[model samples]
Target: MAMSPEQPSAPRRSRIALWLVLLLLLALGGYAGWHQWRAREQAVVNSTQQQVDALSERLNAMRTEQRAQARRLQQADSLNRVLRDELDGITQRAALLETSVERLADPDRHGAQALRLDETEMLLTIGSQRLQIAGDLDGARRAYALAAGVLDGIDDPAYLSLRQTLLQERTALDALGADPRVRAIAQLDAYTQTVTAPAGREERARDERAPWWQRAFGNLLQVQPTDRAVAVQAADRAAALAGLQLEISLARAAAERRDTAGYRDALRRADTWLQRLAPDSAARTQQRAQLQALAALPLSLSVPTLGSTLQQLRQLRAR
Candidate 1:
């Protein structure tokens, strides 16, 4: 059995071949396992990178939200400060106004003076209304004098000027003279007394001047020239007198209402009636002259400074 080294036995050769095949198989298996492990590691790294990107996007969004909330909070804090300052200013103003009111409030002496001023004002207003609207001169004068008395009673030195104003108003009122309506009424009364008197003498004189034949027929049928003034008929004499009286009454009413035009017109109408009633009488001429004079009288009292005292009083009270 000791064969040469070059020519080995058959079993030994077979065993050598099997050992080489096994070694080759073990090397191939080790390479395959290493390739699989590298592939797995690469997959794990890709997944980790994707997760990190997602986390970064979420954190940025959260940071942006936080910044916006902080800005809104700052704006809200500034607005609250401004509102608080305004409220404090308003409260201070209210307190100052209340203090000023408390310092100026007075109820005793101020109340009395205020009452006097009110009375004076009321009296002045009544006087003005009486003169302008009702044309009651006497009533207006009385009211003005009473207003003066009330104004004088006010002892406030600040209102000393008001006394002078009221006095001037009184002086102006006194200077207006007597009411023309009073004179007109007196004249009318005198005229009316004469109007009711008989026209017997005038009629007899006219009859005596007529022709004898005309006079004989005068009782039955009177005839006169058309150019001559027509006398009121005997049957209508009462009504004519009544119309004349009504005209005079109308004139009086117009004067009372301060209607200058209507007063003049009514007086003119009365004069016309007077002409009809007693055309040739001396009394008629005199009465007509009186009516003309009465018509010339102005019923309205125009004074630019009439209500100056009242205006001054009101201004003082306002102050």
Candidate 2:
């Protein structure tokens, strides 16, 4: 029962060793928990940063698109405003033109005004008719000239707008007639008058000139009595028909040559001469048929658009 002191001390030592081992395990566990907590915190912070970066990029793109859209909207708005302003100006001008036309048409019109209206109206009618029926540029220009002449006398500031509109319309019509095809027929007609007669003409002229010297100087230089009343013997009906037929043939040739005026003139002369030929002649039927063929030929230029300025002026005048 009496234990030694050394045995009691041994128990004490063993107790100390167990206590030290438990402390070491607790310290190691604490260190491991701290490290895991720090790693978790770092992971959370990195994820938040990535989300913020993605959101920032999206916001920047949205901002850029919005700015571009704003610019486009501003440009479109500016364009619309400009167009509206132009439309407003046009409307105001149209109203002014209408009012002026009404005043011009009123009773107690001035002498000069009446003259101007009459001449302008007549010229407009002439120009329209020429363009519509024959597509005659020269005729249209003559009408336009007459209208310009009438406008030339107007000194009143009140008439300036009307005169300007007329000038504009004339310019529009001039542009329409600028094409060469539109003028070919009239140009050909002018050429027809200058064209020399065909081959036999030189021989006939020489034959006539052979007798000219005899008529100029009588025998022994005596003055010959002129037979002023030498009646033209009735032209042989058959020969007349044949000559008209020849004219039609020449007209066809001219048509082939693209000589519109020469063809028309020749055909017209032939038609007139055909009428003079005896109706009973056998060639009359054939000649009449030829005249019909010539009449069927198309010589008109392309129909041009009547200008809007003149049309508007007319509508304003009516109002």
Candidate 3:
């Protein structure tokens, strides 16, 4: 009935314990390997993120450097332009100085007689052109008188006839009157201010106030009166306005050139344009007086010519 020593049972329990310890060791090794793998993956991800951040910083620095370089290039271009302009100015000044030195070195430019003659001739030319173009009679007279005085100082018997011719031209310029085109423009401006209603427009406005039935009857029978004053068509009036303005400007130009006939033609064209645009004789009643006054002026006048005198002076100078 008493228990003896059981070695097999004890050995079986020891073997089972050994198996349990081996299983525990294997599970611990698996967990340690998984943790190390996860750590390596996280480290790789962090390294990649750091490399991307470094690349972005390098890109930003490159952009900033490029922008600064562009600014420097623009500034250099501006500075070069300024320097070029200054250099050009210096070159011009140098050229002008060289011209002055060259003139001083020439011996032929020292004579007072030649200088006076050239100056006088230039004055005569300016005067003749002024008289012919601008009708500046007074300015022409003064210039001719000055030229005659210069000729007198020359004390040359060869220019006697030239002096007499200049005197004659001076007398002719003294007789010239003011430009007549100025008065014409004044008259036109006055006429323009004299706009008036056409004859039948007022009567039509009164007739419009009648009863509706009466107006219908009048309109149907064509017995009651309405305005015969035709309104200016918008398109025609616009064209006429342009034409009138052009003609007026031409008239002014002709007057400035002392072309009496041309000025008259331009004025007449403007008048015709106005008539065509308005087409109401009664409306022109207000401007009739101004129109008559404008028409009364002579179309042409006896303007003195100095071509012969100028030619004779040039011939004398050549002699």
Cα lDDT, all candidates: 0.79, 0.64, 0.69
Q: Write the per-residue lDDT of candidate 3 for residues 1-319, one digit (tens) a residue.
A: 9998966788899999999999999899989999999999999999999999999999999999999999999999999999999999999999998976665565744456666777788888987777666656667777888887787787667667777877777666666554455555666555544432232344456468867886767545544125533334345556766776788678767765656788778878877766655545665543544554565665333455575567886786555
Misplaced by over 4 Å in model 3 are: 1-20, 111-134, 147-319
The TM-score values for the models, in the order shown, are: 0.56, 0.34, 0.47
Off by over 4 Å in 2: 1-8, 110-319
Clashing pairs in 1: none
Candidate with more favorable, higher lDDT: 1 or 3: 1
Cα-lDDT of candidate 3: 0.69
lDDT of 2 at 310: 54
Q: Residue 91 in model 2: shift from native, Å?
A: 2.1
Residue-level lDDT tens digits of model 2 in 1-319: 7975655578888999999998999999999999999999999999999999999999999999999999999999999999999999999999998977767776756656756776777787788788666656778878877887876786756556767777776776676645344344344343333222321353345446756675455333634237422111233444555676677667656764556787778878776655654333455465456456544555544434454435654664565
Query: Who is ahead in TM-score, 1 or 3?
Result: 1
Quick one: best lDDT, which candidate? 1
What local lDDT does model 2 show for residue 293? 53
Best by TM-score: 1
Candidate 3, residue 120: lDDT: 80
